[model samples]
Target: MPRIKDLRAYLDALAELGDVRTVDRLVDPHLEVGAIIRRSYETCAPAPLFTNIKGTAPGYRLLGAPGALSSAPGKPLARIALSLGLSADSTAREIIDALAAARTREQIQPVLVDTAPCKQNILLGDEATLDRFPTPLLHEGDGGAYVNTWGTIVARTPDGSFTNWSIARIMMIDGKHMTGLVLHPQHIAQVWQQWADLGEPMPFALVQGGEPALPFISGMPLPNGVEEGGYLGALLGEPLELVQCETVDLQVPASAEIVIEGHLSVERSGVEGPMGEFSGYQPHETSMQPVYTIEAITHRDDPIWPTVVEGEPVDEFHTATGLTLAAEALTQLRAAGLPITTAWEPFEGASHVLVVSVAADWRTALPGVSTGELTQRVNDVIVALRFENLVPRIFVLDDDVDASNVGELMWALATRVHPTGRRIVRTGVILPLLACYTPEQRHTATGDKVTYDALLPAAGKGREPRSSFRFLFPAEVQQQVLENWPN
Candidate 1:
């Protein structure tokens, strides 16, 4: 298998699998391009290649729904899988398992090279312009044009002991200025605050389009102090390559399609968002966030910029981050010694829910614990998990439930989960975008989290197994009927 090194190769891989659709007809970058990507995601249509974007330089192009789910019947996650260098038909479980295993290997530091394609054309200081590349107005309700939905921001500690690569939304504030959030407790913000305390602007670079792994590992919720470069190397079974930035002290992927190097002003702020968030809401959120002043721009000849339509589930946001979230959560649960067979974050949940399976025959969290105790232990750990902040509703299912199947998940929710007996409620930091929170609750930054236990109670008295049409007949009888049925 060829290792994914850049955006063009990944696009070629998508084309090879018959999952890419190109549009040579000019499309406006404002709402027209965003609507097409949105429709493509809602329908599980092919990834789009907008060859001609209106009001931009000829060489600029856009890759819509870059790693969104494929509509291919047997390979819905084909784009995501292929991006990770896995088989086109790889399952969510397989992808998660691979990521979990990769975390255990030794970190492979990225190699620094002197020259890179990203620097083929460099614009310094005043010459560098953010709008020159055509920032897309992703939604009509968006506060401004979004140019960083899928890009990775490079930031590290002042001493450079802990470097972080992360993905965050950025809104264009003219040619030299851009604004984006650094949510409290997130690594990027934590590091930026350190620089703020010292009264020094933090050097930074925004990278768009390099190893599909760039964004994948960037989004993984790994342990604090752990950099993504090593984990990404382990995931790809090779060292990541890097190149020094022209204007910033940090380095970016040598193969990146475009690099925007700048300094995040410590004393500056700008009104950043109100974008259609991943939680499917366009909240009335606009804040004075950190201002990134552009100092240099570099890119390969005719580069492709990637963007995601993030509002709803089954979109690029869900497809790229869903499986990774499940993988990280599953790893945490197993390490904590929970009896979780597997976990799945159904794309329909967006970033709000996680479904985990436990075997029907399994019982007890401790040697002599009661079923209630077992459930409590499981609930306690998940409710307090770091990622649980993003997940407010967790469904603990029996092994028979196909967590990946939306139909099965819905059936499990309907028949087993109840409003009272099986549900436990707790409060956590509820993101403002979740619809469950009223505007008041959203403003308060807290909301209720419900843990729904849909598993069979122990394996004893009054045990009622789930009812499914497939289980209506014995295995042998069903096989005979299928073999002898009239054509």
Candidate 2:
């Protein structure tokens, strides 16, 4: 399959592949839409296209979980692979390897364009009303209807040297107002802080749908000073075509379905929160957050709105957020000259846990490794990275275990890990987003991150070869079962 330019093309491809289904019946944007998408995520079912949204206007539709796991046995993560312009049958390991390789490619900058599809239908100032769209109240417990679940927020430093692209949860405040709650750790918040220091509001543009890679790279934690558009351009093997925003100096994808230009006010603050996060928990309280007032709203003739369902494994959070981050981490570790051969976060872990595999012959990577000092060295390198903030635990595995396979990881965890000496605990600033932490730990923003050694000592009496189903059954016998078992 060719690279998907935007969300609409991906959805159309899903329909043709029988990977998506439409709900002809009316569905409420409140709890109903949430319920359906949640179930779809759990079952790895087809993507749900809600045609009869309760408050949808003509030419507007709601697409739930655009790249959620596919139910197809042959290619469960097929949708996620396609989102990054890979083959439908691409495995998780292949995707990670591809991303790691792309890190070495020269980033191609975006091409400047004028009058994009996103500007086909435009509303400025008072006309930039958000009430007309069917912004879904994803969760019943959510404080308000969220319109920016899967969009990209573009922000630039006050000096104009750095541009950050990220995904932050947003709540609809009114016709032309919205509030976003971003942690100070985010690059966007850092840019906002820089603007606040200058006593000026930050110019911003929110893109609802653009290239399929937009959300992927948005969730990706690229290095500081690097442009996301350029990185994405390299990944796609083509330059991203960008058009200047009407109200903001920054640019948005020309193929974007909806673009909202705004000024993120630093002085003004509003209450925002209690939405379900990828950690599978809701915030207990709401807090005063900066408000982003819309200056202009632009979109195509007929636009499809994309949204993600948080609070579970195998959703957009796990597949897109988890997969992309792991890929970037792999690249980072390699660049740092770590012995890591493969890295992945299992969907079963809700994207919080990381499994890193290195060469089984430890001496090959690190000299004088008998005392386990190299383990701590590699662990330190990973925990110190600014972009690898989501990881709470890193499981160091031997090359024998396939880090990409959840089943293989489970087996290694059960057999290789020890409760005492093999574990290395390092203290660090923990993000409050990690649901595993207690409220006290979250308040302190610090915790002991763990690294478990899942590799056997290279030369030891305890070290022994393992057996499995593949080894027990010869290829001839396996082929006979495949040839005759059905009959």
Candidate 3:
């Protein structure tokens, strides 16, 4: 299937697949829309399209759960798969493998255009107010109505050598002002610091409803200094159409539903967050972050704002990030000459645990290898690659066990991983959002990185797995039973 070029095209495809639900009735952006979207994620329902959002002008709409899992029978990853230009029924492993393969291809730069649909309606200076859009209060205890939950924030280094398209939650402080998370070492924060050092506000463009793959790549953990647009192009097998931002020097996806060109203040005066994050918990504390001043706003005739209520399991962050992180880890591990078969971050783990599938004959390749030695080897590679922090916990399972499936992963951990020496703990930089960390650990950004040797004993010793129907029954008998079963 051809890649979905724009948001509308993707939505139309979703409609055909019965994965999009259009809500025409009036819906409040405060909490009602968020509630529906959250419910959709929990129930694996179709993506919600709120056409009659309250307080927004005519033709303005809001799309919730844009990257959330689908409810289509046996096709939970359909939405994510479609976003990546794959078939609706593509499996998790296929999607991850595709993403990993794309990384090896040459970077396809974006094609700059003279004009785009986002320029159909332009508001400048005083008219460029965020209030014109129905930004939603996604969660009850959220600090404010977030305007850039699923949107990509476009920022470029002053030297123009690199451009970063990242997804950072931006909260609407007022009509013309917003605040967002810009943490250390992040591409955005790195560029922002350079601009701050030069005593100038960092130029930015918030792109909403761009090409279907925009958000997935934006949220991906690509290498430092890599332009997301080029990676997106490589993923799509063609260049992404782009248009220069009106106020900022950056270029945005030409067909974006909404583009807010602004200057991110160097001063960290604005308090941002306490919003519900992907960790499935809402931290009560807020932080001082950089402020964004909206200088210009552009959108399509009838724009659709894509919002991701970032909390709990199986949301956009879980589905998209899980696949992206897995692809990254897999690519890096394989490139380092590791005998890794596949890697996956199950949605049930909320991006906390990385399930790494090693080759079944790893012991044969390295005679009489101990679990601790293999665990150390993997840990060294992860630390050397600077991914130890991102992957807090890792479960090493044999390739025969499907790590993508939550049930299979749980079973492997429960049965294969012994309680004593199987668990390897190492101190390292840790993600603060993980619930396992305390306030002090989060404050210092230090914690234990755990790796569990969930692989079964060597040569299948001390284990019996001839229990399931597929394993117990002969192939002929199984085929006959399946053929005779009523549909």
Candidate 4:
């Protein structure tokens, strides 16, 4: 396994693995190039590199669908594995297991360097120009070009002890200005709001493409005040090197491909929306978001622009966010002393739904209980609902069911759950993204939800033994049957 320290190194690794394919033919960045990449993501094809983007320098390039999919066999988790310091052959179970293990390790702090390759060339004050870069106008109806896609925005709390790295879309507003959507509940937005309340501009740095683990950690829903850089260091098994920004009082990865130093005005607001999101739908309203004044721009000689074309499930954004959320959920549940067996955010759900399989011992622990009791207990264990703006719909299952496999989970729900007897609906705490729920009902307040108890009936009450002889088949016979089946 190769350890990549920066975007250029990682791109080299991807090319070596035959995961990246370059198209030398001239392509337009306006809409043509984005459409091609969108089609590639839809088909789970190789990462496409547009080397000859219209109106851009020859060396300037765009890496579309970088974390989209893997062409390897029996390795659907390849992209995530690479991002998390695992081999390409790693399985989904292995990826989850690795993350769980890392969570238990000691934290490693990142090292700061005085100079780095990211500062090979710097544009300051009036020289900084956002239009010089090949920021893609991704969707047809998008309001403006988005400059930061797979980038990480670094911000610190008022006390400066808590540093946060997160992924949020940024749109180019002018030659030296941009607007970013910092959702109210997200850490970035929270930090900005604190500065806004104090009547101070929030200094920030946007780093585009560094170590894969860096961006991966940025999107993770870790506990508030957890240092993302330290988490990345732990994941990489080496301390990441950082350098101070030219204008902002912030530090960014020394090996980052491009660094944009800016400040968010506390009193300013600008139009932000109308771009197609990961849900494959655009919201009807265009709202005012925070405005950022770019102070400087720095990058290597030739930088590779990495972006996620957000729309529909199974896209790059969905996969990256899903893996991080699932891992974070598992960590949170275990920390709360819950015996969570498995957890998965189905790509089709787009982070709106979470499926959890818990240990069967819960049924015995709470005896003489009706199906509703199990549903309430299961709901109590879920931690995402407690998050202000991320209340996801959850489906609880027995240890035997695989949360990642929708078909298996559905089969269990159909055979074991009685429609009227096992379903429990609590319509009080839902996320706004769920189209099924009305906008007014999906606010941050507690909303309603439903839990379908699909666990097998307890050992008594006229029901057959949950663990029967037929259910425990010989392992060798099962293996033989699978081996004999034709593809």
On TM-score, the leading prediction is 3
Candidate 1 Cα lDDT to native: 0.83
Instruction: Rank the models by lDDT, top first.
Output: 3, 1, 2, 4
Candidate 3: 10-residue stretch with minimal lDDT: 457-466
Please list all clashing residue pairs in model 1, or write none if there are none. none
Cα distance off (Å), candidate 4, residue 260: 0.5
> Which stretches of candidate 4 lie above 4 Å from their native place?
360-374, 383-388, 413-431, 442-447, 459-473, 482-487
lDDT of each: 0.83, 0.82, 0.87, 0.74
Write one digit per residue (lDDT tens) for candidate 1, span 371-486. Answer: 55556666787765556667778888877888888988898888878667867789878756677777888788798888777766654666675455466677888788778983
Q: List the pairs of residues colliding in candidate 3.
A: none
Estimate the lDDT of model 2: 0.82
Model 4: number of backbone collisions: 9
**Number of the predicted model whose lDDT against the real structure is largest:** 3
- Cα lDDT of model 3 by residue, 1-487, tens digit: 9878899999999888898999999998889999999999988899999999889998899999999888778888888999999999998889988998888889999999999989999999999998879888989999999988889999988898888998878999999999999986578898999999999999999999978888898888888867888888888899988998887788999979999998999899999988888889999888899999999999999899999998889898888777798898888888877788888999988888888889977887777778777877777777765346778888888888787777766777887888787777889887677777889998888998888877677654775664777678899988998999835
Give, for candidate 4, the lowest lDDT window spanning 10 residues. 383-392
Clashes found in each candidate (C-alpha, N, C closer than 3 A): 0, 0, 0, 9
